[model samples]
Target: MLLLICFYQDQTSLLSYTAAPSPHPSWPPAPGIKLCVFITRLTSRSFLTLSGHGYGVHCCCFSSCGSYLLSCSTDGSTMVWSSDTGEAAAVLQHPSRSALRVCAAAPDSSLLLAGACDGTVALWDFPSKTLRRCHPVSEASVVACCFSPCGQMFVTGCTYGDLKLWDVDMSLLYAQKDAHDLGVTCCSFAPLFQVDGCCVQLRLASCGQDNQLKIWIVSQREGTACTMKLLHTLTSQSAPILSCAFSSEGDLVVGGSVDKSVAIYDANLGTLLHILKQHDRYVTAVALSPTMPWIATGSMDRTVNVWRIGDGDSRTGRKLPGHSGLLLAYWSEVDVQTWLCEEGLEELVSIFKANNIGGAELSQLNKEAARELGIGLAESLGLRGRLLRKIKGLMAEQSGSEAPDEFLCPITRELMKDPVIAADGYSYERESIESWIRGKNKTSPMTNLPLQTSLLTPNRSLKMTITRWKSSQ
Candidate 1:
């Protein structure tokens, strides 16, 4: 479960990470908002889309200068999209496995990489329109990977706690087995902080299923690789640390958690500084921009939030529409309408029954009438059987109902059903609402972010404060 009020920020060109929380009285804390992976692009704009996948966009990154954008999927596909036109430049597909994570243009412009659940890192050659190659990682899936500043090397972390380094030639150099006691969900190489020439002395940060943040300094010596020691291990008060990233300063580490909160740490000491509790579900992604003063985050709540850092407490300020794709459900008085495209009355009837209304009531069909009333893309059936007439509208009289809308905005108190439409009259159909509930909406513990952080980071250091969205009265 994750949500970002906005994803208009980044780190490669480097301020990174965000969440909901308060800071120590004087440390100039980072602002926080709940929902994982504070999402942000270099530009403060994003297109709301809903037609491609049943799931929300997962991995998003920009080219070196923040020119081109790229994203991949759990549905086994990768899309390179033009930021200017919002059109797909290419779509790379996976076999049975889908990409779990993606690393955008390395310092080199010719290549891109995607980490897959199948324990393989898939590489792309921009010039050739084909999948260039794949390199096996480990028994477990690779969840996170990052490139070094020079683009000379890359590191991949597996869900089973292994971190492996690979040369550009795709040969293994260093493999740290059991990088975490539990699954390792994210990994990054410090940008400016370099090692004493063993390829690179990378500062590595990892978050995991173990509920702790682990940091290590790795370097190569005389053809032998060495790790300095565990720099720090910050244990959480609640759930495991799910996602983590570094700030441009190389001194801050931020992360999202399963506990429904956003946490900030002094990158050097692993000191917990701020926390954000503005979301009601697990935070999925977090992002921050070095040049910009704002932090944006997304969540399973289907909303993106923005905050200011520097206050020990998360000073929440804005919640924006994170998704633009609308699922316009057009309900009509007519009982028989088109929902899918296919032929055959009897077979289509059975198909809808099997797919849409699973385990729904079944009866000997009136074969002749079914042929007369097939549904289409432009039509909708009655919420229930129209034959029942006057008393049928009361849902309590029925056995059960459609899975109750997956989302309910705490602020607007409206059911986020499918098909949001601004109707001819001033009424809007439930498209945006439905997309939020079913698409991005998740059921993790992260949704429970703190609404107030006065007890945490106090008086006036509030970096960015979210305008308290009025909740349901």
Candidate 2:
């Protein structure tokens, strides 16, 4: 027989268990009263415990800047907490007077949304703490909600197994009926997107009571036409999946299941990477840190587990401290050699050095360039494939640094093709600033002061200047 004991303290919890002898007369009783005792001490990494909610908390999310935390509860209200301190900044009552089931903050931190049990969805201006819109989105209760990476649109999942996409004005743009078998439990949008001319492609993941996780490819064209298609369906978990999240880079997906297991998968390949079984009860919530290689999971057993992704080793097989923060566009021949060694292509280091392939030349290398370099240089197809993938990733990062700060939107941080001047006397991308204003923010995004007006004027001069800059490049 085994006996377990637990002790709770102000900051940590202590657990102890003991194993006693079997109670059988004929059982081999070797030695006198053999007993084994094990003592385990579990410490909490959490520094604060938010306790303002009167009922159970159904969902919680952090702001993009990590300054605020929003939690929805069954007490008919949503509470916003200061992430640095344990202070309840504000409490927002649900307009439906029903329990709030889920909440989501915009990627730009300009808007807040809360879904109620009565099928009501409320949008609030995050900066001004003012209600913007409250509408009934579905016949059944809304259980899941998330904002797109651009902050211009959001998706809501209901208990009726329906998924609806809405713009910032609460206008329904698209809807899919019976997305899941029973009901949609949770959904998340990837943090990155792909641009194909005038269309933007996004990846969305949703899990439900059907014991499955589905990934969908959502595309938005130049006009109002939008389309969605099923990309991948994952059935790694035996039980129903309760929660799902995407990594910062959108390369990995994690799901928590009612079977008390957490499964991590490759978002692109749709393959399972790892399964973690630590919680004794149903795992209800999962989140991946945007700045660190850590995952946090919450369970119905009232325990939260934090797991690190790697074993303290560098992700690229080896660490190169000298080239830690250096950009790929400025790497020298020696730096390229060091990177080759870090990526386990040390055998090709001599060849690359002989060719004098620096960062600038390496970033311009493609399949044709690789073939032109020589069949003997990159003879192995496997080696050439890995080198090209790494080079492509590096080139993408380099492109991000090529854009000038003046031509980039302050909110989205991307190069602006259509610049507009807001009432705050600052220029921003037309779409980005329009979304911020539509979110009901009366304050300026840069100065945080009340805006003179809500009107925006096209900045033709800035737009022409950006066009010239692009042409020169």
Candidate 3:
């Protein structure tokens, strides 16, 4: 979850404040021992590299039990490897497809979903060792996929900035929305909870190439389609966010950015909590340990830094040498937080109360104090201007600048400049459909059926209308 530690100049007296406990039964209880001593006793060297993917790895995740690691690569393959040995256990491919970019393992580890550069998602049933289905969900490449905790549904983020929700069978499209302008790079489904009677609450966090991180709440009405409503738009990052993950308890969001920094945010409050700039180059991927208060960050600098976290006494950066192309990182879950609560230094808890920082907003207030001591509050205040500009631009786009639904590309959700009628008797963006045919195969991106021809006929009437609309704007 979101672990808040308030560190003072002493460094030894690290105190932590805990948030409301998660209702998910799958989450393990927190650790019983203090973080500093517990982490110190663990092995210092924990880096392991899976060396089979021919191209750069893009995303990787640990299965719920931590027995296996699933990773997708630019090589167009998704491999299941033994987490302990780093040996490839199975390789998944459609023979015609490669360049798989993202993947997600079901919470029960019974199924796996792999997203490809061609925007197709492959659902695999591991027990039967069979390809269940290949779903063509978008024309632009699929960059991120996350399964719901209950395994009843999944969500995907596409390169064209579309976010879609699909049923467990990958048959029904429950909902769809345009989440970002340029492209949606990453998305994850937070653990669901029951709110009022018969009503469930679901939150989705997504980061995009547009340099925005958004939280959406998904709801459904009887006999109506599922809908996703934007809850918060977090835009404090000065660079594009490439990777994002929700804490096992769904209380925190950790993201890696192109600006050579890793940002940790409070999921409930949508506040940027900490920015760790340990890497020399762009931070491409980030993962939180399932069992401990640790965060693993993979960077373009060819280094994997395992950061030891504390309630109030976080350790300095520690870089570990590993894969030359470290694209993804993931950790298994455990109850480090509960352990600390039971056996941590009681004196530090009293210290936290004395400082008036023991309740909600403890993380935000403490992080701000830390920034005031380390850097100046000026930098933190400066982030607000950037965030405000992004929000204002978003508001303007949402109010009256929205294009007509027909003028938008079905795949990208953005305006379609070059509209063309495909063989499936549907109009699509020329570049989007052509890329799907050439990259994913000759199948229809919208129908996933064999097309009569790859050629696209220009939709002149729609194009003219789009042009006129843009001129009016």
lDDT per residue (tens digit) for residues 158-201 in model 2: 88888889999999888989999888989999999999999999
lDDT of each: 0.50, 0.71, 0.62
Once superposed on the true structure, which residue ranges of model 2 sit more than 4 Å away at CA?
Answer: 1-46, 313-473
| lDDT by residue for model 1 (19-118), tens | 2222322212233322222332223453233134333344666665544566665545666665555566787775544434555567656778888766
Ranking by TM-score: 3, 2, 1
lDDT of 1: 0.50
Candidate 2, run of 10 with poorest lDDT: 13-22
Model 3 RMSD, rounded to 1 decimal: 15.8
Best by lDDT: 2
* Top TM-score model: 3
TM-score on alpha carbons, each prediction? 0.56, 0.57, 0.58
List, residue by residue over 13-84, the lDDT tens digit for candidate 3. 221111112133322223222222011211234244346754345566667766766767655678787755
Q: What TM-score, to 2 decimals, does candidate 3 have?
A: 0.58
- What local lDDT does model 3 show for residue 102? 83
For every candidate, C-alpha RMSD to the true structure in Å: 23.5, 23.7, 15.8
